[model samples]
Target chain A: MAVVLEVEGLKKKYGSLEALKGISFKVEEGEIFGLIGPNGAGKTTTLRIIATLLTPSDGKVTFLGFDLKKHPEKFREKISYLPEEAGAYRNMKGIDYLNFMAKFYAKDEAEVREFVERAKRICGLGERLKDKVGTYSKGMTRKLLLARALMTKPALAILDEPTSGLDVINSLEVREMIKGFTREGVSVLLSSHNMLEVEFLSDRVALIDRGEILDSGTPQGLKEKYQASNLEIVFRSAVQ
Target chain B: MKNFSHLLIKEIKELVNKQLVISLVFMLFIFNFIGNVTKSEIKKAMAKQKIAVLDLDKSEISKNIIGALNMANFIIEEKSGEKEQVVKELRSSGLDLLVVIPAGFGQEVSNFRPGEVETYSYLKGISMTGSRKSEIVKALLQTTNEFLSNEYLKKKLPDLDPKLLKAPIKSREFVVVRDRMAEGSTSAVIGSLYAQSFILPVILMMIIMYSSQMVITAIAMEKQNKTLETLLTVPISRTAVVMAKMLAAGIVGLLSAAIYMYGFRNAFSFNTGDIAKAMSGVAPILKQLGLTITTQGYALFGISLFLTILVALSLATILGVLAEDYRTAQSLTVPLVFLVLVPYFVSLFADINTMSLPAKILVLAIPFSHPFFAVQNIMFGHLNMLWLGIVYNFLFVVVMLYWTTKIFSTDRVLTMKLKWGKRKVVL
Candidate 1:
């Protein structure tokens, strides 16, 4: 598979603290790659850098062979990023939010309507599309955000803590949606603290700790390498 | 290009969703209505004065004086009782003024000696209200003196030329600038009063209330919603986001200003003829004060106001970045309002040329002050000061924009922590 994203020697510092320390990674097309870590493991920071949200102190990132610094607009056009605990304008209805997202892709009104309909069905929004987002539950808002991210049908989707606040059912639904993306030859780079989510959705996993990747492989491969039966034990052993 | 268009659409959508546009329109309607109503009341009150006449002489000359006063717009009320009743009324504030003609006034005047007419009013007892009434009475007496002199010359010197009796020292009052003279009509006075007491305050209120809160809340909202991070991830430059926000704010500010001005004009039943005449004289004065507004002065005024608002909004954005929430953003507006009001108060109390050096410096430093000063200069025909005001206002806007953009571009604005009084630190 073609490499959809590449990062080299990524380093970021905030005052006296180093959030990212010369970290590097690659995400291939048609793969669900998860960066799993603890609460302060810099998973979100890494994802932010990959999404072009933060400028790395010393590093280079290229998305689909386009340098982030040189062609950020082009890279943004090809990818959709959902930050951790992402929020939508609460006063706008779900469908309006969807249409608003679709506008970034230059989709006509008719195209937006059709796209929102498809996204709504896939996200199981149903009649809730007419209600203001402020009235939505945490899981519902997450679903709405996921639906909006998918509406553009970009080649690469970057999701940070995509199901952090979701219920089990919504989490499973999100997992299914992410799986659907891989089936359609689209790439995904997801960061999460949920080991179970990582084991279930990611075809490949990178266990990161303190801004550095401790280990990288398939979930089962990481478990086998650490001589553990589960990815959780592998993560614990790797961190130690 | 497509993404920029999308960004603009999303901004407009968010602005609409916030219901700011609707609220501003409503505010404009209500404020304008109140301003116009107040203006009309003031105009009606100033139209004419009521005067009390005490004809102690009961002579034809005194009667003729009373007749002339009655013919002129004064509501003349004759006191039938004694001098005590008239004096009591004047002191009690029941009468604006008392015109007391002495018993021998007609015989003395016919003998060619100066006839005395006494006017009485309680000056020190009452406040401005009583004082203004006394001043008006004094002015009427001066007019009466002039009329008496003219009448005496006409009657006694029938064979002599009337022009020869005219004073040797003839004074011709030529206004330095004539444009403002045309606005001397009733409507012009009303319009100017409205512009001062109503239009200026409303404009300041709208600019401070909306621009300060809106700009700050917009930035803080993005931060709270975590959308700032998402937007930062986009390929667009960070400066682009700031520019987009400023542009959005400018649009909102201009829209609110237009709505307020429109409502003001419509609600007041503006007399266009008076405004035109007033504006003509006002134009040259405005030019002198550093503002050159032509027949199309309204357009220029609108543009200057828009630019001034944009500068204010940009400053608000910078202040907003320092705020962590909507409430903090709102509290920040108080100082902003004080800053805007300083210039207005200075313009009100001090003349353009005679303003204290510090006041002049402060006014020159503030963009909004120039507009206030320029508007007055234009209306009053102070041409020399108008250009200086316009240039200073323009420069202030430009400098503010540059500084605000710099502050926005720096990461310090986004990450800086705010410290509260003594106990807590707010982000």
Candidate 2:
């Protein structure tokens, strides 16, 4: 399979504290790859660096034949990044917000309309999309943001917590949607701390602790390698 | 460029929302309400004032004094009661003032000695109208003194012209601006010019203050909402992003300034109209003195004003990136607010032309000072100085925009931290 993203020796520092210490990962085409860890395990830092929101202090990210440092705009052209708990313009209707964001990616007005129409159907807010985004519930906002990320249909999508802050039902719906998107030849690099959820979702899973990836393989492969039942026990056994 | 336009349109829509429109309408209504109340108060102050008079002399000069006071818009009511009693009962009896003409007062005036007229004024609360009423009474009394003195002079100098005897010297004042001169006092010409063009500086200040604040708030809200991270990763030129935000903020700032100017004009329309009418006789003199702004001068001033506003907006954009949330945005704007306030107050209280060298340099160093000095610069044809100001403002804006774009391009936009305390990051 063609690789969609490559990260090598990625190191990020905030002030004097090292956040990510030489962590490496790769995302291949048409696969759901998850970086699983605790709250302060550098998952967000790694995702942000690849999304071009932060510069890696000591390494490189190559995406779609473009170096992130040298050609960030080029990297941006083929990817969509959905931050954890991201928000839309509060004063705009959900449909209008989608339209506004769609223009930045679309080549013409027709493409913008197509993107927004896809977003409307994917979000499933229906008449609720006519109301201002400020009035949306947390689950509704997360769903809308998920729909926005997929509507662009980019070559790669960097999702930081794709189902963050959603209820059980909403979480299931979002997981199904993300699974559906990967079937369309779009690769994904998502980060989360929900081990069970990630084990159920990612085709390949990486167990990260502090700032380093301790082990990485398919969920079943890691579980078998560590002689554990689930990916969570595998992570505990790998840490030990 | 197309994405830039889309961002600009989105920014404007976000700024001019339903809540903002409703707030602006409410503000205008309050302004108009206050304006009408002030007009009624001013009219009451200008109406005829009632005064009580106690005449002990019962002489012809006393009668003449009372008649003169009555003719000068005072409704005189004679009182024969005790002096202290009449004075105490002045305002409670619908009188604003009390005058006592003592016995033999007319004899002293008849013998060419100045006689004193005792006056007691009722106390009123400290307000503009209250002071205006007091000033009217005070002015009428001075005029009456002049009349009495002229009468005495006529009687004393029977063979000579009393008018010429009273003023030994006659002089005419003329004001000059560059080579052009007009037959008027310099102060009068300056006053007329200020009266007509003060609104420009006021509007400039309002636009800068309102617009910069709006930018900071917008950036802060984006941060608070956690939307900035997603926004920065989008496929658009970062420089274009900065430009779109600045331009949208500039447009909204102008809109806010327009609404504020409308409210301000409505509040002071009566006073401004009165001043224009009072200075009507000096209109030709003002023109001769070159105190008016020409078309070319106005165009130049407008450019300078635009550049200054851009400079403010650019600085504001940089400051806004440092803000952590909506609550932190207000304190972050303090520095920019101080920059605007310095020029505004200095231009109001001191003349930049006549200021000391150090003070003048300091004032002109502020980019906003250029528009505040526009009136004097246009009047004196200080085209070189004005052009220098234009260049300075342009360079200032460029430097600020470059710095802002640099921040946006780098990881500084994400990791930049600002804190009120040494160890805590507040914004």
Candidate 3:
């Protein structure tokens, strides 16, 4: 399989504090690569850099052979970012919000309409899509945002804690949707604090702690290597 | 281009909502309603005034004096009885003025002794009507004195006209603007010009402040809602995003400016109806003295106004970027408001050129102050100053736009937040 994104020595700094300490990773096409860590483990910072939302202090990000630093707009055209605490324009109806996001990526009006229709099916909000987003429940809004993130059929979807605050049912639905998208040949770079969830969803998981990637492999392989029954045991043994 | 329009339309939709439209219409209705009511009241006050006259002598001169008062838009009420009785009655009679011609008043005038007419005026509250009544007393005394002086002159010296004897020397007033001179009352010309130009600084201040506020609020709301991050990552030019926001704010701010100016004109036109007519009368003299702004002058003023608004919007964009939430955005607008207020009051009260060096430089440092001075600078043929202001504003807007786009284009927009009473930094 072809590699869709390559992050080599990704380092980011804010004033004197080092957020990412020269970490390196690569995401292959049609795979879910999860960066798993606890709170304040630099998971969000790594995801943001790959999403082109922030420039790395000293690194190179090659997305589909285009240098992210030199051609951010080109990368932006092909990648979608779903921040952990993302929000839609509240005054806009859900369908309008989807349409607004689609137009930025679609080729023409027909494409925009097709994207909106796809988003409608993915979200499954039904007639409630006609109501303003401000009036929607949390689960409904999360589904709508998820649909937006995937509607454009981006080459790479960068999701930061996609199910961090969802209920069990909503979390299952989001995981199913993400899995369904990955099966269609979309590469995903996701970050999460839940090791079990990452073990369940990601094709390959990288254990990150204190701005460094301690270990990375298939969850089953890491569990076998650590002589443990679960990936959480693998993470604990690797961190120690 | 398409993305810019989409952003512009979405922004405008967010700002110009149903509630704002309804409130603006309601305010217009109220301003017009109050203006019409006060206008009619003023007309009624001008048409009629009531006064009491205690004609003690009951002579021809006293009757003639009462007739004179009657011709001057006053209703005469002749009172009789003791002096104290009439004087006390004046209080309850609801009359503001009373004249008491003492007994033997005609004998004193015939013997060439000065006639003493005791006048009683009731003190009332200091309303427009109450203050105007005191002016009437002065007019009353002038008319009575003129009539008595004419009578004395006609009897003592019958050969000369009283008008010519009263003013042997005539005074003519002329106003000179640069080289041109116009024959008119200097007061009338200055008053008319002041009336015409006084509202401009207010309008400019409002436009700048309103435009900046719209930008700040819109951006802050986006930040509060966390939509700004999603917007920044979208596949549009960062500069286009900044421009679209400022453009939308400009459209809404100018729309509000037009509506507010129309409402203000209607509200004040009723009270200053005569002033408008007088302005029209003085328009010719103003033109002769080169006090009117030309087409070129107006175009320059418009440019300055446009650039000034752009500068304010740019500053507000930076401020909004620094703000963490909606409430912080409102408090952040204080600097922009103060920038506008300083120039507003200065233009309204003092001449900018006559200000002290430090004060003048301070006022001119604020980009918004330029448009406030543009009208006068153009009217007075100070085209160089107006041109310099337009250029300076243009350059200022360019620099601010560049800086604003820089802030929006980078990660600084997300990470650079003003957190009060905290010392943690995150990336």
RMSD of each: 6.2, 2.4, 2.6
CA-based DockQ, model 2? 0.81
Minimum summed lDDT over a 10-residue window in model 1 chain A is located at A100-109
Q: Candidates 2 and 3: which is better by DockQ?
A: 2
Model 3: chain B TM-score vs. truth?
A: 0.90
DockQ of each: 0.43, 0.81, 0.75
Model 1 ranges off by over 4 Å? A106-114, A227-231, B32-69, B72-138, B145-168, B172-217, B234-240, B266-271, B277-316, B332-427
Best by TM-score: 2
Best by DockQ: 2
Q: Chain A of candidate 1: what's the TM-score?
A: 0.96
Ordered list by lDDT, greatest first = 3, 2, 1
Name the docking class for model 1: acceptable
Q: Sort by DockQ, best first: what order?
A: 2, 3, 1
Candidate 1 per-residue C-alpha lDDT over A3-114 given as tens digits, one digit per residue, 9 for 90 to 100: 9899898888887789888888889988989999899998988877667666678889989789977776777778888888788877778888787777666447788777
**Interface RMSD measured for model 2:** 1.0
Backbone collision tally, model 1:
25
TM-score per prediction, in order, is: 0.76, 0.94, 0.94
lDDT of 2 by residue, B1-427 (tens): 7888888887788778787789889989999998898878878777876777899888898888888788877778899977877777775766666778998988998887888788776766655655665576677668777887888877777788777887879989988778987788777777777777667668878999989988888788888888888888889888988888888888988898899889988987735677779689788998887777789988999899989988888888887888888777889888887888888888777778888899888989989889888767887888888999999999998899889999998888876768767746432
| Tens-digit lDDT string for candidate 1 (B1-427) | 6666567666656765546767767777797778677676656446566778888899888998888777666788887678877788677665657788888998898776888887876555534455655666677667777777777788978786555678556554323335333223344444444443445655665665565566677877776766666666555655667767766766665566667667766666654665556567444434443333466555555656666776677777777777666667667677778778777666555565687787677666776666666566665566466676666667777777777666644445546544445434332
